[model samples]
Target: MTDALLPNILQFIGQIDPFDKIPKNALRTLATQVQITYLGKGEVIDLCTAEQEKSLYIVRTGSMEQRKVDGVLRAKLGPDDMFGFSVLGKDASSDKGYRAIAIEDSLVYIIPQTALQTLFSAHPDCAEHFASQAQVRLKSALDVVWSNKEKGLFIRTVGEVASGRVAVVTADQTIQAVAHEMRMVQRSSCAVIYDNDTIVGLITDRDMTKRVIAHGVAIDRPISDVMTHSPLTIKPDDLVLHAASVMMQFNIRNLPVVEDNKVVGLLTTTHLVQNHRVQAIFLIEKIKYAGSIKSLASFTPERQAIFEALVDGRVAPEVIGKVMTMIMDAYTRRLIQIAIDKLGPPPCNFSWIVAGSHARNEVHMLSDQDSAIVLSDSATDNDRIYFNHLAMIVTNGLASCDYPLCPGKYMAATPKWCQPVRVWKEYYKKWVSNPEYERLLNISVFLEIRTIYGNSEYETTLRDALHSNIRNNREFLSTLVNDAITTNPPLGIFNNLVLEKSGENKKTLNVKKYAINLIIDLARIYGLAVECDLSATDERFKAANSQNALSDDAFKNITGAYQFILSLRFSHQLEALKQGQKPDNNINPDSFGSFERKHLKDAFRIVADLQEAAKVRFGSR
Candidate 1:
């Protein structure tokens, strides 16, 4: 390339990832070695040639398509998109008849293997982008988003933040001895009681005041007498967000960090309070004590604030989903309690369950209510009336707290969803046996159910019945697989542009309908085919992989794609919220910069490939 054109080449690649990650001086040198070439619309390049030297190709001016030996489409590439990655790394695998064909008269840039190696030598961080494994490349893409992040509470493990000032005592130790040890050793507020080598119990300062002093118990008694037996613990490797969840769920102020069955350190409310960023982690505690619906509704702003902090902290998308879901759970459970107080206790045993996104623990800013109730079989018609009133109160209260009512009435407040346990089992039996496309909309929402309050066994019984019915009906999965693949990802997103210029969805893309939900549907099919009971999308994919339902490479690529797309959706929603707009799933292509647009194409391609594979696998069964 002439030196005059080098600056233009530098500018084009500079805005794209991995190249953007390269140092400016090194990138200028890389640009100098680029070879510009052109291809006619029908021309093809043999990517797996035995005689040709290996090289990387980047489209500069027009579009192209890659294909395998049998002419199956591999990917669609547009300007700034890359190919020839299969031949870049040390463990580069054979393309096995894979080739690139220009769909338009194209201008392309070729980087010789030697020139690429020279760049990698100076900037090793950029080399992972060319890695043969899809997971490595996907991870490198995600890393670019957090490249500016300084390691903070969201990224640090529990071990990194926990205090090592835990007071360890034997189960046989006297209560007075344990208290003295706590005071003498850093004034630790909690003690872990061990029986020989095993952890037996945990005691807190409150236990001393209430169980000892308040009860007039002798101080010489064994500490086990007052300690909380089989207290919940967290692993050192766990994220602090997880520990925060455990503490909020159980209403504990202190938590022991245990690894290998040995207490190593302690995490307490004081430790969490030091980081203002974690204030949202403890917001659930406040939700627990809110006096009424109006007070609970006031926490909506704080919920948005928590989401902003989590995203700004660069927390993983799945973890962010979980944190948001826990807050929703807190709101639901608290609202139920408030309803009970107003309407009096239920006349019979029942379970208030959540379905769809809530059950999946995948709740986000745009998520609304998808819930139901399971009543005991012995309930009378009068009992039904009472439960119906309670459901109505909780559902409307959730809407007051910023969670919108389900547009389809798929809530506990809906008469059809509030049923006796046996009736729920009957619903599952009918859905699995028929698997009709018309009933799919309703069936899909309740496919994953979880109990949030009341009798837990009712939820378990429903799940067992559902799974049993699915296992016996082979054609059910085939029908689901067919439905899942009907909406292919927008692979032409890059070539034709990322948005529709006309129609009801003009100037925007419905990412939830076209991309995210497609992956969720596929995961559900795979999960059900293998009898996997997990509700979360990522976990269901993982469970499917373990059971050999999906190959290792397929599993990693699909899950990574799902995570990337979800993160983008969350980011889009956050930006809308910041701009004082109502959050929704419609994303404008014009909003995406070069960096996001490029990776989104890659993620879309991955989902498309997996969908094709699913059609072949389950369509035959």
Candidate 2:
């Protein structure tokens, strides 16, 4: 390559990463040694089972289609996208490897692996970005066959396992005596009131200690005076895991089991810990025991087993979510290591953020991947190169693992989505301060971000800033409310079922998009305004109640709406996964039983009513 053409060649590679960090001299040398290849449309670039090499290929122009061994087109890659870096990694597994072929006449830049490694070593930021991207990709690949084997595990109703022994006290009983009965029975908690075959209140040891002993209040006071009235209770026939969530969310040790408005039994946290048989005991043990990723990977097979256990255990949706989050987190970290081994290293300090359902820690079997990168503000031009490369690696890796790329271009690899921490903060400020239609949409999407890997403190700082900005901005809150209200559940003109325009059940509507998103948006706005730290929509609703953000009636209506939507989504996904179909948000109401349909309709009505109230509150503004 001549000096005159050297700058152009360097510029093209610089547009990618780590290469951007190479000095002018080294880049010129690299340009001289690199090869530029051209291919006509329909030409094969690399076939399946081709000899692997330690080099990277960047498309200078045109596009290519990646295919599987069965000849199915899997992905399309355009200019600026690169491939073949995985050859640099230590992993020898290639059974599920992809083959590349030109879709259109294309020009490509190929760089030797040694040169790329030299660049990465000289510019550590580039290496980091490469590593991060690779890790994300590996994680995605692993998720594909990670196994949901535990899907059929035993799920029994609370009524089936109830001890049939009740520990109860009258609402008029003294707190002192109630505490005595609790301790004498070796129980951490007890139901406070059993009246007319109804459960009116609950009092636990913590409540007694905090409300009476700590406050220096007389223990002789009526239990009703210190009891938690109208406490969050579940029906006896409900899933035990649901009860577990109520306990975890409330930080309580026990929950009252209500049957036909009567207190039947008390469910303790200890009981669940003792009885729940987790299949992937090894995975859980590894996660709890391992202090590093190296150790965590040693139990990778166990991780798969754990996933199977979760599928089979019939664990409550909430617990399943928690477990999945833990596994995914570990998986992502390991992939990052693999990417780093392949790409070399990062150009600068950065954090990989998880968004959407995963960020909220509510991922289901069919969930897609949503993530972004937050680089340090001090990152130089060289840093941008590495970060961009890292993003691509992670996004593509995730695609291989069964998480389809976010159709909305919300993946970490996109420049618009990847930014320095300071830039992200500025972006948040702009969205919150302006609160325009587009900005509001961006805020709604980004606010759901949760730190899944790297520098978690950065995520915390960003979240705190968001809370501070939104809490003080009444106008922004109002705008959010207005935006949230716009997507009201679609109720038919005759107040009957609103059907879909197409699909197997053409007459059925998607409850997730219309109903669930409505509640999620409403809860998000309320939570933001109140500076609630909880991430999940359901958890946010509960937090909103504690903060008195909604009236008791409104709270009940929304809670019921949330539960109905959740149940519907769970069932739909369960059936879809069972049939080997891709789980999706689209749901057909007609497929549901009459009672289920009625509950869904009622939920939508509640959502519609709340939306109207929201409009009245903010639409006028």
Candidate 3:
């Protein structure tokens, strides 16, 4: 290759996979040994039988697919995706052969076996990424993409940043003694109350102030009298981001860090504020106290900034979704309070529950309002009026904050969705017992539900009813599998990508519909088949794995596929937001370079494989 083109090739390789792990000077040397060649759309490279020198074939641009000798599709390739790893090993045999076909006009980079072996000798660790197994390489690529030198503040684990000097006191100790212990520790905003070698309660400074001084209670009384019983605690390994959410959700300032049911340290608001690199915690605080919808709406810029920061931080997609969901919950709760102030206290007890992405805790920048209100059975017609009005204000208020309304009118503002507990139970029964295709589409969104506000028992009651009905309904899961398999990943003949034939999104792929949703549907189907009530996609798969419905490898591959595809969608959205354009799921095919295209193809293939598995698993019924 010419010197000028060599630099370009090095730049491309430097940003991708196992190559990214190589040292700079070594990468340039390796780049020098690469020979660039072009192949026409219908050309084929004989990987085993050809008399040419053995080499690693990396696609620099365009696309290709590998097929077994019997013509079964081995894998689809895009830019930065490499083949010929098998031949690089000393034990490779011609009997285990596959051929690469240029499904699209392609530019291929050929690295002679001698050069790669030499490079591997110098950078021994890099060899693992070139394992013949596609799973290993894909995992290596993920590790490279996720690892960072300067980690974000919230991404750190609680144990890494929390103070180890905790004040542990017996429940029988007097409040005066506990305060003395707190003073001695020098790290105490809260003290863990232990009894018989078990954590039984917790007491903070606020407890001393309110329960002792303000109430004129005797300080000589046992701390257990005022301590919070069975206090909520976070594990040492959980992210500080999650700790922050827990604090915000319950409106507490102190959280004891526990592991194996033993107190290790404490995470407080002080620690969170001290390490703040982003405004997520602050924005959530603002959302909580903001009295006016206009004030809440004005924080949209700050909200977007948090999203951008989380994406750039390379935090796990599930963690990012949780952080985003907490913020949304804050907004929703505040709006409900504002409505209550204007319309008077609620006429009856109710629970404001969310569905779909919101319920699954997988929300993103594009997530809309998928919620409903479950009223007390005692609610009257007058009560419905009050709630409908309340729902309108909250939904519109969410819109002003840039969370658009659900296009299908799934929000609580719709009377059909805002119903009493009995009606909600009936809806689940009819949908599960006699699912029609039209109702199947609607029920899929509500299959995962969570209560964010009001009487949580209402949610528990509804969930139990739904799960019971689902377990008794034999044909329900198969129906869901049938619907889910109807929309396959956009993989076509010769493993070429299928794109939108025409329209505004022409030549674009809907990653959500074609890839992410397919995995989610499979998780839900498998999750429910075993009576697993968890809402999150990853958790559902874990439940399936634990139940022996999915093998360990299948579970990991499918979940990894989900995370990779979701991250790509998030990156695509971030790009649009930076360009001052609206973000949607339809991603332009041309926008993906070889790196994204290759991994995306891998992710798509994983989803398609699981879809077939689901068909055999459930469709046989």
lDDT of each: 0.84, 0.65, 0.84
**How many clashes does each candidate structure show, in the order listed?**
0, 30, 1
- TM-score for all models, in order of appearance: 0.88, 0.52, 0.84
Between the candidate structures 2 and 3, which one is better when assessed by TM-score?
3
TM-score order, best first, reads: 1, 3, 2
Predicted structure 3, TM vs. truth: 0.84
Per-residue alpha-carbon lDDT of model 3 for 278-367, expressed as tens digits? 578778878989989999999988888888888887877877898898889889999999999999999999999999999998889999
- Candidate number with the higher lDDT (1 or 2): 1
In the range 1-621, model 2's lDDT, one tens digit per residue, is: 456766788777755544554577766666866778898998875634547565677778987766656675444556666666445545435435557788789998877778767766776544543432233332222222233344432345566555555567777778888777777763645654765556678887777778888999898888888888877777786656555544543567776777777777777767777778444333443444444445554664454445445544444455566556655654565556556666787777788888877887776665677788888788887788877887776667656544567877877888887888888888888999997887876777788777766777778878988987776676887787767766657543121235566757565566666777788888787677567777887677778778877766567667656754665576676677667676677766446542343344445656776676666655535
Which residue pairs show collisions in model 1?
A: none
Name every residue pair that clashes in candidate 3: 79-594
